[model samples]
Target chain A: MVTAKLLGLVFFTCSLEYFSLPHLAHRLFPAWSYLLSAIVLWFIPIPLLIWLPVISVIASSCFFTRRFNGGADSVMFWVGLLLALTYTTADSKTHFSVISVMTIGFVGAFAYFMAGVSKLLSPQWRTGETFQWSLSQTCFSETFPILRQHSRCLSLGILLWQLSFPLALTHRYLAIFYIVSGLVFHIVNARVLGLSRFTLAFSCFYPAILFLSHSGDH
Target chain B: MVIMAIKGLIFNKRTLPLDLLRLFFTSWSFFDRPGDSFRTRLTLYQDATPILEQNWPETVSFKWWQLIFNPAGNDWHYSKQLESCAAILSQKYPSEDFLQSREFKQYLNHILKYVGPKSFDTISVLLEVKKYSANADFQRLVFLTLPTTNKKTFI
Candidate 1:
C-alpha cells in the first residue's frame, strides 16, 4: 500500500511537469522578475516563514484573477490558484481551513465526474466489452500473456469501475474507493504496458483527495 | 608494428623538440577557426618559427570571442590552415618510414579528406571528427566546412 501511494505521488509529480504548471507559472510571472522575487523571498528570515504560504496564495490568486481575463488561460490560472490555496490551507490551523480542504476534495470529485460522464457519453466506453479489449491491448498485451485468458473478467471490472466512479463522488468512503481504483488502473497499466509516464500524468488528483481526507480526520 | 612506430617517433630523442612543436602546431591548427589571423599566420610558416612568434597565450577571453564572434568564418579559415599544416608536415617529413606506417597514412588521409573539397558533404564528418578527437576543442572546424557554393540555394 505504501508502494502504491508512493507510485501515485510519482505520477502526480510527472503530471505537474507535463500539464499546465510550466505555462501557468510563466504566464503568472515574468521570467527574470520571478527569479529575483523568489530569491528575495528565500532570504527573508524565520518569522516570515509562517506568513509566506498565505502571502504566496494571495499573490497567486490576485495574479491569476487579474491576468486570466476570461479564456482557457483564465480557467488554468484559477485552477492553479486553487491548487496553491489547497497547499497553503493544508498547512494552516484556521477554522475555515477545513472548508478550503473540502473544496479541494470537490476538485478531485469534479475530475471523476468529468471522466465518468465522458466515458458514458462515448459509445465505445459504454459497451464495457470494447473498454476491456482496448484496456487489454493498451495494458496487458505486451506482458503477462496469461492476462489474455482473463480478458472477459478484466473488461467487466474496468467498465464497472469507471461506471461507478461518478456515484463514488457522493460518499466519502466511495470517493476513497474510486481514488484507490484510479491509482490501481494507472499502476496496472504501467507495470503491464510500460505506460509509467502516462500513468504519472493522470495521478494529479491524488494530492487533493489525500489532503481532504487528512483534513477531514482532524 | 604501427604502435611501435608511433611510440618510437613520439619518443625519438632527436625529434622530441620538433614533435612537441609539431604537436603544438597541429593541435592549434586542428582546433583553429577559419579566417582567424592565427590561421593566416600558420600558412606563412615554413618551419615552426612563425607559429612560435604568433602564438598567443591561451586565455578564456580569446576563447569566448572565438566562440561568439565570427564563429562560422573562423571555422573555414582553420580547416584551410590545418590542411596547409598537414601538407607542410608531409613535405618536411617525407621519409618512407614515416609515410609507410598505415596508422600515420590513415591519420593523414583522415585529415586530408576532412580538409578536402568534400569537407562539407555531411554533418557526420563534423561528428566523426569530434568523436575521433575525443575533444570538443576541435569542434570549431565543423563550421569552416559549411559549403559556400550554394548559400543562395540554402537560404
Candidate 2:
C-alpha cells in the first residue's frame, strides 16, 4: 500500500506536469484525457480504484511512445502493474508479494548492473574521457569546474559502484548502503543533469530493495 | 519484455510492442559513453530567403521546472530522436526517400509544432552532430539536411 501510494504520487506529479504544459500535452492526448487520468490518479488510494490508475499509467506509457519521458516512467508502470496484481491475489498475499518483490528486485538490479556494464564497454568511459567531456557539455561545467580536475577518478569510482549494485541485495547493511548511495547519486544527477524525475522515480525501488534484503530475517 | 530485449539485441529488429516494453527496462545505456551530441536547426523560408530560423536548446529554455516536468525538451530526448534518424538514414535508405518516410515526417511534424512556426513557403531542417576528441577539441558536422521544400506534407 505504501509503495502504491508513492507510485501514485509520482505518477500524479509527472502527469500533472506533463498534461499542464499545453505544448507537450496537446501533441499526444486531449485535455480531457489528462484531466481524467489525473483525477483517477488522485483517487488511487481508494481500495477499489487502484486498478484504474495502473491502467491509466500503462495506457499513457504506451500512447506516449515517441514522447516517452524516461526509464523511470517505465519502471513506475512495471512496478505499479505488479503491485496491482498483488492486490488481486488476496488469498495468497504472501506468495504474491514475494513474487512481486523478486520481479521488481531483479529488474531494478539488472538496470543498475546494465548501466555499469554499458559504461564499462564504452571506450570513452574506460579511458575516463566520458565524464570530463560529458560534464563539459552540460551547464554544470562552469559552476562545477573543480569536477573536471578529478573527472577520471570520479568516473572510475562511479563505474565500480554501478557494477556492484546488485550485491546490495545480499546483505541488509549493504542494501542500506547502496540505497543511500543511490539516493545521493540520483540527487547529484538531478542537480547536475536536470533529471529530477529520476530521483523520485528510482527512489520508488528502494522500498523493494529493503524488503528483499530483509526478507530472510522473517 | 526480457525475452523481447534479448531477441532485439540479437536480431536488431524492434516492433512497437518491444519499444513500449523497453521503457520499463531500457538497459539504461543512456550516455554510456561520451556520445555524439546532436543540435537540430529548423529554418522557415518565405521566398528563397530565410524568414525565421530556430535552433533547439537555443529556443528551448533550460528551466529548473524541467527537472521534474516538461522533460520532452530535455537534451537527452531531443538528441536521441535526431540520433536515431541519423542512424537510420545512414544505415538503410537513401536520404531523399528517408525525408519522405513516415517516421521522418512525423518527427518533423512534432518538431515543427514544438518550434511553433506560424507559416512558411519552405522549411528545412539541418542536423549537426558534435564529435569530441581526446584533447577536448570538438568538430561539428552537418550530419543531415532536409533541402528546402514547399511541402505542405510536413505541416
Candidate 3:
C-alpha cells in the first residue's frame, strides 16, 4: 500500500505545485486550490484512501487540458486512474494491489515501448544522428552536453530504455533492481538534465514495482 | 532472480503481461519518421534581456524544476501554436500580419506579465520554428521582434 499512498502523494504534490500556486491564485480560486491541501493531509498510508478527491483533482486537470505539459503529466493521468482501482476488501492486500501494480507496470512499459519504437523507426534515430541533432540544440543548458553530443551514448540509452521493460517482468529481486534503476535514471535526467517533473512523475510507479517484485519472493 | 524469471516464462508459458509488453515494443518499432517530443522555442526579451531561454544569463538563476515546471506556463500553448504555424509556414512564407498576430501578441503579454521584469516597457519575442520540411532539412524560421510598450492589454 506504500505504492498506493505514494501515488496519491505524488498526485497531490503535482497539483499543489502546478494548480494551487499563488501565481494561479486569480484563475483558480484560492479557496478551491487551498482545498487541495486536504489531499495532502489525507495522503497518509491509511487503508481507505478516498477515490472521490483524487477523481476531483484528476477531473480538474482534465478540464484544464491547456496544462498538459509533458510525459510527467501523462504519468499523473495514469496514477489518477489507477488510484480508483484500489479496493478495500479485508481478504488480502495483495489481491487487488498486485493487479494494480501490474497495470501500472504495463502502462509504463507501453510508454517506453512506443518511445523506443518511434525512435527506432526514424531514420535519424537509426543513424543516431537525430540524437546528435537534438543534443546539439542551441537551447537551454543541457545536463549532459558533452555526453549528449556522442551518438553512441544516446543510442545505447535508447536500447537500454526500450529493452529494459521485459527484464523488469522477470524475477522479484531483478524487477526491484530494474525499477530502482529506473528511478535513478529519472533522477539523473531531472537533476542533471533539468527535466525535473520526470523525477516524481515517473518514480511514483516504483513503489508498485517494488511491491510486485517483492511479492513473487514470498 | 534471472533463473526464476526464465523458469516462470519457460514453464508457465503464460506470461500474458510480459508478452503484451513485448508486443507493445515490437509494434512501436515499425513507424519511424521524426518523433515529436515537444521541442519548440520561446524567447522573451525585456528591452535586451532574454528570460528563461538559452540566451538568458549563462548561470541560469532558477533550478531544474523551476525550468521544467516554469511559473510562466508558456510551453503548452506556445508549443501548439508553433506546430500549426510550422505547418502553415512550411507551405508559404508567413505574412507580416500573421507574424504580428493577435495570438502572438497575447503570448508576448503573457511572458512580459508573468516571466519578464516589469521595469522594462519595451519587450519583443523571436520565435524559431524547427524542421517544417518533409525532407528533414532542419528548417529554421524566425521573425523580427513584436514590440510591446506597456502591459495594458495592447489595443
**The candidate that achieves the highest TM-score relative to the unseen native structure:** 2
Report how far off residue B80 is in candidate 3 (Å).
9.6
Interface RMSD to the true structure, each candidate: 30.3, 7.0, 13.7
Order by DockQ, highest first = 2, 3, 1
What ranges in model 3 sit over 4 Å off? Answer: A19-49, A52-60, A88-98, A136-145, A214-218, B1-106, B115-117, B120-122, B130-150, B153-155
The global Cα lDDT (0 to 1) of model 3 is 0.49
Give the interface-residue alpha carbon RMSD of model 1: 30.3
After best superposition, candidate 3 residue A17: deviation in angstroms?
3.4
Tens digits of per-residue lDDT for model 2, B1-155:
33433433443234457666665556588667665556667777676788788765352345566555545434345444544565446446876777666666656655555555365666667665554443343244334444443333453
**lDDT against the true structure, each candidate:** 0.36, 0.62, 0.49
lDDT per residue (tens digit) for residues B1-155 in model 1:
23433444443445455433432222111111112121111111222222122211111112222221221222233233344343344445654653454333333333333233421322211211122224343232211122222111220
| Model 3 C-alpha lDDT per residue in residues B1-155, reported as the tens digit of each score | 23433433454354444433332233334223434322334455565776434321122234645533443322333334444444354346466765466444444444444444444544444443444244453344444454554444442
TM-score of predicted structure 3, chain A = 0.74
**TM-score of predicted model 1?**
0.34
Where does candidate 1 stray beyond 4 Å? A1-80, A87-97, A132-153, A166-176, A198-204, A210-218, B1-155
